[model samples]
Target chain A: MSAPPLLEVDHLVMNYVTEKGDVSAVEDVSFTLHQGEALGLVGESGCGKTSIAMSLLRLQAENAVFKSGEIRLNGENLLALPEDEMRRHRWKDIAMVFQGAMNAWNPVYRVGDQIREALDLHFRPRLSDAEATERISRLFEMVGLNPAMANRYPHEFSGGMRQRAVIAMALSCDPSIIIADEPTTALDVIVQDQILQELKKIQRELGMAIIYISHDIAVIAEVTDTIGIMYAGKLVELGPTVEVFARPKHPYAYLLLSSTPSVTGPRRKLAPLEGEPPNLLNPPTGCRFHPRCPFATERCSIEEPPMETIADGHRVACWNWREVPVSIAQEARP
Target chain B: MTEPLVKVDRLTKLFPVSRGMFRRPVDFIHAVDGVSFEIAPGESLGLVGESGCGKTTTGRLLVKLMEATSGQILMHDDGSMIDVAHIGSDDLRRFRRRVQMIFQDPYESMNPRRTVFDTVSEPLAVQNIGSLREREDRVAQMLQLVGLTPPNTFLFRYPHELSGGQRQRVAIARALVLDPSFVVADEPTSMLDVSIRISIMELMLELADAFDVSYLYITHDLAVARYMCDRIAVMYLGKIVELGDTEEVLSNPLHPYTRALLSAVPVPDPTYRKPPVEIKGGITKAINPPTECRFIERCPWATDVCHSTEHPPLEDKGGGHFVACHLVEKGAG
Candidate 1:
């Protein structure tokens, strides 16, 4: 409890040098993750969720450039840290699980060796191959993967197993934080669920902070302690998971919860959003969500609303979010 | 139901493996194996399954886009039944108008270069309909149907100019421009965002009711299937293992595969403590597959009788509920 929360971002504004010129990717985005908390960053594809994740660890692509912001890991300024100095903090302090990174391992190398390389490089630089192998087995065991199968090549394992291998690699350094972006995309639902459960168990036992980014609301709803809604390049809303799900203040938040298809809870079909996401390079003026918002007013098109605190734990950024009814969505297509 | 609009009987599509100069067929992958179903007029039936299952193949086969290796496809045309399987290429043109498909990826399915007007109007031109003026009117009408306001403003816009949900609307408008009676929507909302996905589904439902269109909705998302489908068919590796009322099949999935699939969906509740069953391996390879139950390798309840032979024929368990499994077969016997 004396230690700072795992990660914190204050007014993070990340930009990209695209052909269309510099465009904002994460504008005025801010959030925090406590020890052992799972924060779900939910949004459509290209909604800056990944960009914010990338900026957190300074792993952004060449075209991307951090405009202005403070990304602090345990009260340490991640942005101002020297590249060589940052290396010391990377992986050991915080780790990342890239989107669809199950196949990230070299196909030719045995998965055991891949995990061993991480441990040898990061921690125990003087570790012998035998010692590294033992550490790899521990990491594998920690992730609920059979330690015996670590010697098999990547192709030998199933998609779910490959993802578990990746997760095992992420936990190799015993990092306090893990950023997983669409980890279960390649696997089937059953396998996805199994992997998710394994991930949850790992989070619980190790007491590490997890940042889960996904386009699927159901997955976010299940795994996350808190949820954040992003659009274009702005964090539109943020709150406790149950609070956001129970009383979504942003129209976009309501849209995400309503549109998500749920099997057991409700007897309604998902109402598809009427339009596609706006082009990020030249996102719609005013609020980025205005063009697609059913409750868009004239002011919503002309002026962007600053994210406002609606309740003790709930926040929203929309001019006409109040216009949306509190009654749960009932427009099931007849 | 006055003889289902489209009746598929024992439809099977086999893909042959080729090799040497002779290309002697050593094996066949039964993508769709003897599947039978009916789409009643103005009714929506969901074909739910995981990827690599025969759901999409079955949908394609219904449109005659892929020729079946065996079985018959019958379409009722003005009280006269015509076997679509035997229809010639020339005659199939008219059938194509009546049966159109909304592909899974709207981005890939459409010509990104073509304007929205051109995309919607292309179908009218293909069927050799009215002159340019009349076709434009029809294109405008299609845009209005999909809820794209100021149709003329959209006329000059290309597919890239539209969003995922809008492109899907344009895709739907193209399919319905010909006033098709049957539509095969294959995961139409998978690529769109959650917010957009819901609205598009509602739009499709609206089109179905207003146009009196029957739908064979192919999707892996069970919740969407349950919401829109009057009845559902659960497919696994080229077989319909369960078929029945949407609510019954989802709430009480008799087939182990169906139950597992339903359980896998992550409900929007933090306190929900349902642990998902572990599916140990990937779908089994279907190379020169056997006549026995394909799900035996993965099924939790597999026994000697389940694997010894072709397990169970599809048995109707009252109220039109149908399941093809040895457990159901033994219980009924």
Candidate 2:
């Protein structure tokens, strides 16, 4: 079932050196992404989902420090590469579509010219004006945007169209993987659905892996093939999206899924997870989620649980995974 | 059967867009164009739509935050109905005690310099209902009701010290301290994290029951609306398209726009595949919108009838479900 993983993240750890103390943003988290596979990392704010994405692209902030572990893209350690070599691999091998990036464009420049700049930088041999135009047009069509709208200013395009343009720019380099961080958080539901469908279609046709980082589990459930639930910088659970949604073993994962409200289901009483997320500056000794987990015991507070494989391709890091109820999926059905 | 608590009759709000040296009114944005609805005592009604669809404007109109261009906002006071839309400034101060609003962004709503006690007690002081010590007692009681435990600890803290969820609770406390009969909560939990959002919503539901209050819960998320509202009203470009029982309207959407919206919501189940959304383009500008059906530009089932005729009026379908689309026959659903 494995033809060598396309990207491997092994025991990655990162921290931010703030004035107060060292903020452990990312703990020992590991996951592998194969070619053409889609993975979703979902959690509340400050759960380190964005931190993981930044680490993969080596785009962390100036204060961030990688304490341990390795990120291997096609068997090459991205952390060990020189600055110039890593820059080459950024948009060419792994690209990113940021959250609310539709408004990130320079208002003074034409949208097409902005994309052309990316092609001029990352695309090899330098695309001529005509070639760059042709590439941008093709990319625009791939993302379901009209090629002619490229000349319009950023303010001229609607929110949905600008998002499509951003997606086109991400694919301008034809990267192997695209890391989209909350790609549709700002758009309306109808527009978000359209953009997600476009991304899924493009992923299938172009055979590129996608790592989606989002706080909305519903958005993640719709587009991802594999789901990884992050809590306090740790991957609490990792498995096929269907399996995890149907039979969540981790306490945090179970509470989160049940807490999310849905449009098409019976009106069940949502069980809200109590207590706030633990402060990362002075994190707890054992499991980060022990303070809010319903299944936490004395041992859970003292000893951190390791990721244990329970089913094929399903792993959960919980001392009492068996105690968590498995009836949410059935209860949600009409 | 029972006397309605608040009734809105054809409420409209137009913001003029002036240009040139004279600054003449060249155009107008019909932000809330002839919207109407009623909230029965203790009933929660959800106003839902995409951005720029006039949901927030309607909420603001009800609370008198913005004056309506022309309409009647009638609220029952002491067994008599009063037109709040045109209430004089003297009467407006008294009317404010009965109607309050909880804004969307907690970060911007509360004054950072003011302590929680000052914010919550300002309403009591403005009304001159209690002395300073009594105001403190009421604020403490309200904070405890909103789940900010150890109310004394939060009374003197400024807005910046509280978390997003706590700040929202304080906002809720401020809105409900006066025992308002009606509250308009505009997307109260949109800015909070998912884990914290559910708790805040549950707290609001609990407080509504304890206070015996009616709510016009304005939000963009249909799922959240279903949880917090007893009735759901779907709004398009400055008009109400559908309104009915939340489960009934969601399960059997009569209007095409409502159907498209329900389909577009991402279901949490990975096994579920939604039907393709049969709409085109995004929400259009409301400036000088055509007199014809506002949804014609994006509606998939727009016929010549939709184009030639005036904007359809909301007609009651069977069992209180109302729809405004020309194609939806009366009592269809």
Candidate 3:
């Protein structure tokens, strides 16, 4: 636990400029991931979980403006890097497996050829066709896919196999950090389970850091070591997955957990949070969640709460963290 | 025993599949192959399966949205059995009011150009029910019933103006405007966020209780099915492999497919982790599949006889719990 972190993002703020106005997609978010660690960014849609992932690799859209922040990978500040330098760092230093990545491949091209193209484009002086093919084969095998199926088009592969191929392509450059954004969101339960297990296994084998982003709480809990709960472009809570899920310090975190129905354990009424997510265009004053939070008081509506460490590696940004009841006694902590 | 409101007896639907350069009809996909189930008045039956399992097709069949290849869909009304599958076009119009459908994607279901008032009132207009003022009153009542408060305010808003959850509620209002006896909902909450999805589900349950309506809820998620259904039917490759009480099917899954499905769902809790049941091979083509089990290719317990024989019949395992597996009947699986 004393080793230096592999990736550290501090006070990151990213805004999207539209004709209407400027929308703060990600605001003052901070987190760190150690080597071989898996951190999950869990939240609802428009919560800026995807914005945080995009900012890591500098993949935001044209209108996105980075007002302030520092993203460091292995002591190198990524934000300060030149465009060409950052482009070089992509895929080789930090690779991303995008959402619905199975369909991201060119339907007409062979899976093997597509992966080899990534290697030849990213690395200078280029790997030979034969060398790239060999590398792709090894990557495929590592992702629990047969190297023989490399010549087949994406249409021939099943949903799970196509996802595996996507993962294999991400690993083709041997990146130290992998950022997966909802890799299993569209898949069936069985296929999703297999893909998550394989991803965890590959992360362990390669000793690579992973930033897993997903909207599903259960899916995040399955593979993530640390879980960061985001709401309205802010990290509401960050802690070990077990501690955060079992005993959530933030009220938003607690409400989100209770809202999701569980497959295991006894059944109970889902405690749905009241009202819609706060509008990012005109977000509520003070705490972003104060409008929907049941425990919001006068202070909660006037002043934003800073992230405070309540326990080892557990941080929550709530003015009244102590007032957040431990009503979730049913789920035993790991 | 009282007569069930809706009963499906071996309902089947087939679509011809064409391939190769000839573009000839090579085979037919058994989209809904001999699916049979019953829903009593005010009871909710969940039909759950993965994509391409024909769960949505089954829902479409119930409302006669698509013509079934064969089999009986009987609707018991005032002590008379009306065969829904064989009904005429004139009678079908009347039958539509009794059986309504709620589609999955609210974004596509409603026209963006039309206001909420037009969308919800179309069904009444088609049925030629009441005057203009009466229809408006009815639509207002339905909107309020579905929890769209201050219905007048939302009646003029287009679908594009509403959030995902609001659009779904609008769809629900449209479906329930006719006050149907049986409703077929196909993944109505799947498109909404988790927090909003729960609220929509709760609202659905509340409306069902108030209206005394029976629901044929279709979804690919087991957790949502368990929360919404009284009984669950596990489908695979266009056939119901297992059916039983929601608790029984989830806690004590008899079929291997159901067991694998339960274990596959990532439970939110970290302490309770179950190793996923490994099923070899992917789902086979439903077109011209072997007469044997449709799940044979992916089933771990498949044997030589399983490949040669026809798919097993739904055998009652007591308490109305049924399973279709050759090995389970032989006490080996």
Candidate 4:
């Protein structure tokens, strides 16, 4: 009952300065993950989902500015920490399994070297070559890879194995939280499921909080304890995984849920967001989702809806969260 | 059924992989080996497999871009039979008009300098369809047909001026402008988003139905293959391991390669819970290709017979479902 929560973010905002103007990529987004918990951040492309994940570790590009936010990892404020101290926390405290795992692992290095690099970067351990090799084999075993494949380069492995190698590298440090950004997006369905299962099994055994980022809501629903839907740099909906999917109060959340092909139900003819994602440089006034939202009224166009708790622990940003209409609820799924 | 639009038999293409200085004699990758298939009038055949399985190479062979090392392609047009593979350079022009290929990445394929009008009209111009004004009209119509609104506005715009979906639409417009009876779409929608992917597929299907077009849809994604194809051929390495109706292949896959591949695809389903079979090892390099099954090295169910002997020829498992596997044959032996 007294175990500390793993990772927490409060009012995180990231803006990029372009030749055009300063644009907010993520605005005032906040979520919490307890130890061993997983949070899935889902939305369409250009919805700033990746930006939020990138901001967690100050991994955003030079142009990106963190206007305001508090990111605490096990009671330590990650954002406020010095660069040298943050570098210490990066691999040893919080590690990331990047997207396009095949390309993320260095081609020049053997799979074992890649994993060992993570250990050497942070731990600076005093161990013999034999012990270091044993530790690398252990990392491989945990991620369901053969111990012999340590000698192979990234190119020698297939898409799925390369992904497992990346996971192995991420786990080498035994970090408190693992942030995987679209780790399986480039892989096929079967391989994706394989990787997801491996991730879930490891998360369960290691008891590390995982932040999963994806544009596909269905994938997010599978691994997440809680779900957050981002739209145009805004966290428009946040709730329990099942609640947000089953009964999404926000219009954007409902749209995202219905659009995905559900294995159980009929294939819903994806009603894509009505309009193009806002130009971050010239973002729409008020509720950023209003331009594409069918339920948008004069109030929505003029005044931004503050994030409000519409249900038990479920927050939504909508002027009329109770009155919003979902067309699919009444229509036959395509 | 209406004399089948196109037929390929024993099509093979071998690329000699360089093995440094003093390489062995005539070593081949077996990019495509004795692969044969047919497309009936207006039918869609989806070719599916993982990367480097040679799905794209097979598509290229169909259009005569790369001449098959050995095989015959029987193409019927105006009630005349002509061998597509042995066609002289002179006749390739006529055959080109009847078949077109939709490339995978739209961002790179289309010329950035050309306007949408010029991109779609280039093929028509090659055929010497009509004057400049006439070709422009046709290009605009094609754009409109692909659901790009205000088609006239897109005519003067360059590729950089459009979104990914729009650029792909323009690419699709170029493919269909020739009114080809046979089209090879090589992962046309892989570069697109999920929501736009279905729309593009629906658009392609509708146009095919309207124009009696047959498609050789090549992709690695099975979910999309199931949605867009009437029949599907699952490939392993360079050879087809299974071919059958899409539904049958998805629900009752026979070949171990097909079973492993289908079992691996992770469709976005929160409730989808399947114990994944640990596919051991990695893909084998297709260098100096052997006679045995290429998948035998990694397949868990592989036996000694599968490793030394060639896989049994594609056997009919009824209802036009064909599979090539020694294990399947032994089960029904």
Order of candidate numbers by DockQ, starting with the best: 2, 3, 1, 4
lDDT of 4 by residue, B1-333 (tens): 458888888788889777777867466888888888888989999999877788999999888788888887888777886798778877877888888989999899999999998899999998889899899889988999998888988889999998877888898899889898889999998887665665677788889987789999998878777767889998877888899888777777888778777666655554566556546554556676667877777778888888779756877777778888877753331
What are the per-residue Cα lDDT tens digits for candidate 1 across A67-114?
A: 778998878889999998788777888899988899788999999988
Whole-model lDDT values for every prediction:
0.84, 0.93, 0.89, 0.81
**Candidate 3 local lDDT, B1-333, one digit each (tens):** 368999898989999987776788868998889989899999999999999999999999899888899999998766788898779888888888888989999989989999999999999999999999999999999999888889999999999999999999999898888888899999999989988998999999998998888999999989999889999999998899999889888887888888888889998986676866768555666887778888887888889878889998877776778899877753322
Screening candidate 3 with a backbone cut-off below 3 angstroms (N, C-alpha, C), the clashing residue pairs are none
DockQ winner between 2 and 3, please give it.
Answer: 2
- In candidate 3, how many Å is residue A203 off? 0.9
| Model 2, residue pairs in steric clash | none
Ten contiguous residues with the weakest lDDT in model 1 chain B: B324-333
What lDDT is reached at residue A234 by model 1?
Answer: 90
Clashes of 3: 0
Q: What DockQ do the predictions score, one after another?
A: 0.64, 0.89, 0.75, 0.32
Candidate 2: segments with Cα more than 4 A from true spot: A329-334
TM-score for every candidate vs. truth?
0.94, 0.98, 0.97, 0.91
Off by over 4 Å in 3: A123-130, A329-334, B20-24, B329-333
Which has the higher DockQ value, candidate number 3 or candidate number 4? 3
Question: Per-residue lDDT of A1-334 in model 2, one digit per residue for the tens?
Answer: 4789989999999999999999999999999999999999999899999999999999999999999999999999999998899999998999999999998999999999999999988877998889989988899999999899889899999999999999999999999999999999999999999999999999999999999999999999999999999999999999999999999999999999888998876888888889898889999878889988888899988999999999998999999999999756335312
- Specify the highest-TM-score model's number: 2
**Which of 1 and 2 is the better model by TM-score?**
2
- Residues B1-333 of candidate 1 have per-residue lDDT tens digits of 568998989899989888666878988888888888887899899999887888898999888888899999898777877798899878788888888999999889988788998888988898899999999998998899899888998888988877778888899999899999899999998887777777788888889989999999998888888777899999888989899889888877788888888888888766677756644556765677778887887888888888887846777876778888887743331
